[model samples]
Target chain A: MDKFNVGKHISGKFNEELEAVRNKVLAMGGLVEKQLADALSAIENSDVELAERVLSSDYKINQLELEIDEQCTRIIAKRQPTASDLRLVLAIIKTISDLERIGDEAERLAHVAKASFNKDQEHLLVSLENLGQQVLMMLREVLDAFARMDEEAALQVHQMDTNADRQYEALTRQLMTYMMEDSRSIPKIMDVMWSARSLERIGDRCQNISEYIIYFVRGKDVRHISREAMEDTVRGAKS
Target chain B: MDKFNVGKHISGKFNEELEAVRNKVLAMGGLVEKQLADALSAIENSDVELAERVLSSDYKINQLELEIDEQCTRIIAKRQPTASDLRLVLAIIKTISDLERIGDEAERLAHVAKASFNKDQEHLLVSLENLGQQVLMMLREVLDAFARMDEEAALQVHQMDTNADRQYEALTRQLMTYMMEDSRSIPKIMDVMWSARSLERIGDRCQNISEYIIYFVRGKDVRHISREAMEDTVRGAKS
Candidate 1:
């Protein structure tokens, strides 16, 4: 091979290393996403054991986050990647942070579930299931974006997040109405409200990761822009 | 000047730019810090005019955050600083995010305050003031750390946040108890609780920004670690 091809081969090796980092992050995402799903399922079924497992497994997620972080640090120090590679590292750093917090919120939902399990309350569980389903979908979309390096898909995830947030607010208000109508429903309704909140936070963090993806690709901050403005920006760039 | 002096000259220029960024951040911090103080005073004294003014001024804080964020992005793109310089820019970015959220929370608190003004309900306002005082102190400590770049002082801010959180929990419990005892207290207590919640969130965000300071200065991720562990890490590195 020519010298230029040899140089290209070395660059390919660096890309492989970055891809490995991405794989680790996605793996961590998979674990936490399952944690969120299990947390919701446990609440729906009143399974204390599963709830407890979700809470205890948070330490594992935390450890994975630190390990991934250290790995990224070492890679940056060694390769000193430029442009897209640098942005990918930054996205990895920010995504792991949002993922770790998602884990914490999931555990929080599990704690609320375990507490309400004693009362055998299941009134608002279905609404929570719906919210959880939306969060799960959002998480999947973000991971897909990362895997395919698709900024358009990531922007769509942001739009979906706004819908999820609106659902959460409606859920909270509905629960509040229930509690207001009957004081006896206060404890159970509060648990469900908190669960819906946890789900909304997860959706928001997912959107945050999607914004990082756009930043990774375009080197522009799409965070403060409105949904329409951002869509136009992404669409304009693609065209 | 000698060659070594030339190195110092370049370093001095870098330091000046860093100082400019830090100064702008501190100025932003000062404005939000004042907003929090005024928000609390507006709630305590039932000053509708002040509350309206706080709401109106929130747009300015949002503008400041965007401006500072743009400055950091430009600096990173132009200088491509390494080591401490990189850490400084990252810290500024995270701090700006925290500060912007703080502004939003303060605006939320003011809205609740304004609503309470028309309701003629003054009984539930005292506990909110106490919670506000505690959170105000936390904000001050965070700003002190930013101004001084003192890691130890920043650690103290994180620890103080725990106290503010506890205060919030107690306030919520008291309001709940009041509601449980007398449903007449429900509507007003709900608004008061919301204000307390906004302050508590400000405390939590301040703690988050303080952790960023520790990470930036020491190149350590002290997030999942306990407060004691974080303190020990800082002390170990200083020694």
Candidate 2:
């Protein structure tokens, strides 16, 4: 008749299971991050083989995501985790999804690199490279927070997303100008613009992942709220 | 100690609670559909007041999302529902987030409409109206699928997204052609391009929502997969 005793038994096992799921997600995060780096390098050097490798590796990311998701499903089915544990599983499920999409974006960038390198689009290419670096930095910070459970680090990633978005907008404007001044540049510039848009989206996805961390550890929805409000809420809880 | 008896007692209450959450999500879905319609009308008329109203109403969408998410959280915390019930709650939570973002994109379209109209870019206004109509159609279809739980309807939305993207590409190319012909039209065409991008994004968001329906009712992950694959998978499952 004692609910507390029943809770203790389930909670202990649930935490261990959820932690396992978290570790899998972090591992998937590392794979996606490396994939992004490879994608950039592939684009930078016009490494066709490297680009092909990046494309092939996406399947692995997909398979791993499915596995991790199945594991989370099994955990929820077998063990009725609550509060933080439930949030952790849910967050990981969503985070790996974002991570997998990053892989897709990276593959798209590699595709552009394969097709458009010989074209006269050096400036747009440089812009893409810059955008890629910024997104990678944001993604890395969020993963670090997830791995270490560092709320401050996670919040930093969320803030960086705003800056990334601004950069995308500026680059979009710049690309428009390039295409406007030279009709011949339209096709190449469009390629660069789409790639830039993809990187900005990667930044947004990273921000979504950071939100999941806040939700998991702090149990708050920080999606539409301001960064200052999010930081205050998370920090308030920590203190 | 029979656990089935305990589960039965808990699940009986859990079903009622989950139904309430589902009802809330459906209601919110209806509200978002209305917002999307208002946003399109704002874009067509370049009505700043309507834009402001759309932005203001975003708060209500946000509030509804938070309420539904909190209800799901409470159910999750209390009953610790598993399997189908857990999937339903999780899906509802995610769908609400996507719907909230759809509203944000609509608001964005309205804001840009305000800016473009303020600049007196009458040349590009017709295209904005057309793009708004295209996006509104997509939004209507997505909402219909979600309300009806129709997988085929959802699958159609994804296909429609590709067409929207192609139209956006064509719009961008047309804008580039206009800008290149006369630098005087550059500012006005830029506004057109943003509206086109926003409309394209609305279609993308609708695709995202349709995918959520597929994931929730069908228990499949269709995020990175191709549109054809998604539709085929859904069709195959239903058959």
What TM-score fits each model?
Answer: 0.89, 0.86
lDDT of 2 at A96: 82
Model 1 per-residue lDDT tens digits across residues B1-239: 12112244366766667667888999999999999898899888888899999999988788888788777666665566666667777778778888988998899888877874334357688679877998889899889887777788888989888788888888887877766665555666667866777888899899988888888767888888986789887788667
Candidate 2 runs further than 4 Å off? A1-16, A117-120, A237-239, B1-13, B117-123, B128-131, B220-239
lDDT agreement of model 1 with the native: 0.79
Docking class of 1: acceptable
Question: How much is A12 displaced in model 1, in angstroms?
Answer: 4.7
Tell me the tens digit of each residue's lDDT in model 2 across B31-135: 777877787777677777987888888888888988997797788777777755666667677788778878778777767667754354565666666666777
lDDT of 2 at B167: 74
Name the weakest run of 10 consecutive residues (lDDT summed) in model 1 chain A.
A1-10
Give the per-residue lDDT digits (tens) of candidate 1, residues A1-239: 12112244367777677767888998998999889888988988888899999988999899998888777766665666655666777678778988998999999898976875334356678668777888899998898887776889998998898789888888877876666666666656666766787798889899989988888777777876788888876788667
Name the regions of candidate 1 deviating beyond 4 angstroms. A1-13, A73-78, A117-120, B1-12, B117-120, B184-188, B237-239
Top candidate by DockQ:
2
